[model samples]
Target: MTTRFFLTSAATTLLAAIACGPAHAAPDLEAAQAIVDEHSQIPTFEPPGEPFDAKACMADKKLFSVPTSSSIPFVDGIETSMEEVAEEIGFEFQQWKNQAQPTQWVQGMEFAINNGFDGIDLMAGIIPSSLGPQAAAAKAAGIQVFATHWADTTTPDDPAATHSFPIPYTRVGEIIGAWITVKTEGKANVLIIGSDDVPATTPYRKSVQATLDKLCDGGCSHTYVNVPVAEWATKIQTNVQGALIADPTINYIVPIYDSMSQFVLPALTITGKKGQVKIATFNGTPFVIDLVRQGEVEMDIGESLGWIARSTIDAEMRSLCGLDVPEDLYVPLLIFDKDNAETAGVPAGFNQGYGDEHVSGYRKLWGLE
Candidate 1:
């Protein structure tokens, strides 16, 4: 299938995973309004340094990237960045295929270490505990490993495992929850589907729950179901169906990542809950942007995969070259809704952040120009 079609298929098959994977309004309306208002505007990240020598830094270098979910659109974006950057800088960039499970990532690391890849990029879903001995092996083999999104960040600093960036997942949760509160006038029944396998998702889930609990207090209620990423494809629909069936009062279905829309939307259809429940989530993948624009999704708090891809590549490459890395090398998220989807969302087929100058921004930083 074509790459675009493949992403759509994957988006459907993967909704989000082994994984796992809000409210609005009130006198507290001020806070919720602020959350939405702040994100309503586009976010830009300009590097804070002069260009370094890219040719010298990447000369004869090679890297392997292990993505937790190759089928996910966000992962596709990261791979695009790696390939584009690799082509421009003359480095060998190889990515493991269809690594949708945690175990596959561990094995990918072992392959990278054994096969002499110079660096490793840890995409969001690869857990730290799952690394087993591969991390040490990579370090021992003189490989530089940089992580972004959701790799276990608790470890004491390791040179090989150096450099990590942000997505502000907790804030993402808070914003979604607040949006829910505002929309329902602080009285929405929410069914939240999440993945237990993704540890980072824990905080996002908790923050959302906390927001609902705090804002609604006695007025609103939410039921949460956690599944692992490995089983998300098979379990998400059933789990969500069960939650809705058990409590038919559920008026909102919140999938932490917008990609989950693929799975959730169909489940809502099969369960005959389509259009009965509203959706609002994160990642604002291209499809999600369209969903928000078409009014299929109520809100999408989005981080541009295009921006993420570029930011992640710059972080990994710079760390590989021993340049100054920003403490927050993350691309910020923008909030999307019917009012702003037309302008706030990236144009369809334009790549997540194709409008941005991040490539040139990084090039100036690396003296690649």
Candidate 2:
């Protein structure tokens, strides 16, 4: 495990205090709006490193991926896209379908090791720490285990995986904070919802809380609540309802992950706060982006699945081929709101709107174009 990736006990305590800290008196609206404007544009692809013979490097390599849940559209999309990339690169790719269970993940790892796979990737929301022995066994068998789109770049990488493609989740959190500040003109009252079980959420929440404190100062206020993944269906709506009842002034509900928006939408409708309180979340999941178009969600931070697939493949191939792998996946984030939700698609399409900069850029880097 990289020491830089894990938070110390003191740092964790400090971040907790900051996240729940009291509000200040005024907000720097200008600064908040500046952040919103800067991040709202379509992001371009920047090469993570100099070009290499990715196709050659990937020749005869076998890759398998196990997602947290095959049912999740976001995770499904990325894995499906990865398979497509592997096909184009002329390497064998397989997916181990599972229902977000650690046992299933262990089975997937065992399959990869026994079947002579060159690499295996544990996709979003699947914690590596929970599979320590399985991961160690795979590494022992010379299978390079990877955790992709799981932990944030700021958090320490779990030693279970040989490598990880840390996503910029904290940056997304900060962007959400800025959007909230700008939308409310610096006096926003927010209900911040998250699942503490997801390792990525720690830095994500920390980033949002820190951004709100710096940009809104004491002008903005928020209440934080934890709804673990298993309890989201049963707890999120009621928890949100109770919070709204306690504080009618709350105008924004920010669930760290967009998938949680499903439960939150019901809460808003039940509380008659549908139009009163808006939602903004991470992940460009099509349905959630559709919510943005319908006015149910105010904004969303999007990372195209196709781009993520290419970036993950690029990084993994580099590492496996004994090239220097990037410290993090260079996936670009785009913001979707009422002004631009239609560009993603009238009803929103998976992997649409983010442009093909990655497609062309990666092809060039891989010497495919």
Candidate 3:
């Protein structure tokens, strides 16, 4: 129950007034299209003289697979982007779902390997206790591994050996912290809802904490509320509801992902403080974007858009093709608020796949196309 508030009542009022102004306008399709077109115009980086033979890379008989247990919206995005990449590169693609269970993760890993995958694209936020061994066994089998979201380096072996590219989760935290500071007018009493299952959660939490400590005067004081990893939505709702009942003074709530934030939103509704508390979260799912547009969520750090999946696939392809691979690759973070949620659109693999142009730009970077 470590909660710290930086702004006094007067400061909070002033900040609120500033935020209430017409700070941002509605989404414009033309503007968004222009931005996307600009991004497309940017030249793709080509490896020096095509070091690996693309023909040989595509001829690998084994399957290219992505493994996950659910959680992030971008898992679907990853799969969609991978499918497109596979089509472009002429490789078979497979996907396995663990439904966010530790046991299921092991099962998925075993299943993928048994099914004859030559390479694997691992998602972020799986239970590391299971992941460490699964990754080790996969490596032992000489299967190439690529990772997104959580750094694959957290595996048992030397990180360099386990993952072809490690996405920087800390930088994402910094982006989130900056957005929160602005949205809350430099005064936020943040409650960090976390999961125990994912090893990446620890780093993600710490990075946000560190960023707040550095940016907000009096340091961003927060309470770390532990939520059940399996039933995160229920736990978050229960905890948030209880917290609001006890102290209706909470100014901000930040969850690790949108699915968990679903709980907090209902708690805010029950407390009759729907838009009063500044809600911030990770993973720009459609629900989160709607919350932002409706002025329910103040800001969200969008990790969706399939950047990790594409990166994982690219790394796997590179490794299998014997190309030089980077030790770590960072996926850029987008701060979504009422100003930009509409254009962000539905994530990939939804009823209509293909995320917004902004997300596609990051995807292109990962795929290097």
The candidate that achieves the highest lDDT relative to the unseen native structure: 2
- Would you list the C-alpha lDDT of every candidate in the order shown? 0.73, 0.87, 0.60
* Tens-digit lDDT track of model 1 for 1-369: 655534576676566531333223343667777887777765655775546777778887888888778887766766876687778777789988764766778778888888888888777766544574777778777987766776323323333355555457788888888888888877889988887776567788888889877766545688888876666678888888888788888999888777778788777887888878999888767787788888788888877665676667677777787777765446676777888777643454324433466656767776777
- Backbone clash pairs for candidate 2 read 5-155, 5-156, 6-156, 23-218, 24-218
The alpha-carbon deviation from the true structure for residue 76 of candidate 3, after best TM-score superposition, in angstroms, is 3.4
TM-score each candidate: 0.84, 0.90, 0.74
Q: How would the candidate models be sorted by lDDT, starting from the highest? A: 2, 1, 3
Q: How does residue 342 of candidate 3 score in lDDT?
A: 64
Q: Which candidate, 1 or 2, has the higher TM-score?
A: 2
Cα displacement (angstroms), candidate 2, residue 187, comes to 1.4
Model 2 ranges off by over 4 Å: 1-25
CA displacement after TM-score superposition, residue 73 of candidate 2 (Å): 1.8
Per-residue error (Å), model 1, residue 41: 0.6
List the lowest-lDDT window of 10 residues for candidate 2: 20-29
lDDT of 1: 0.73
Off by over 4 Å in 3: 1-56, 64-66, 127-137, 152-161, 346-369
TM-score winner = 2
Select the stronger candidate by lDDT from 2 and 3: 2
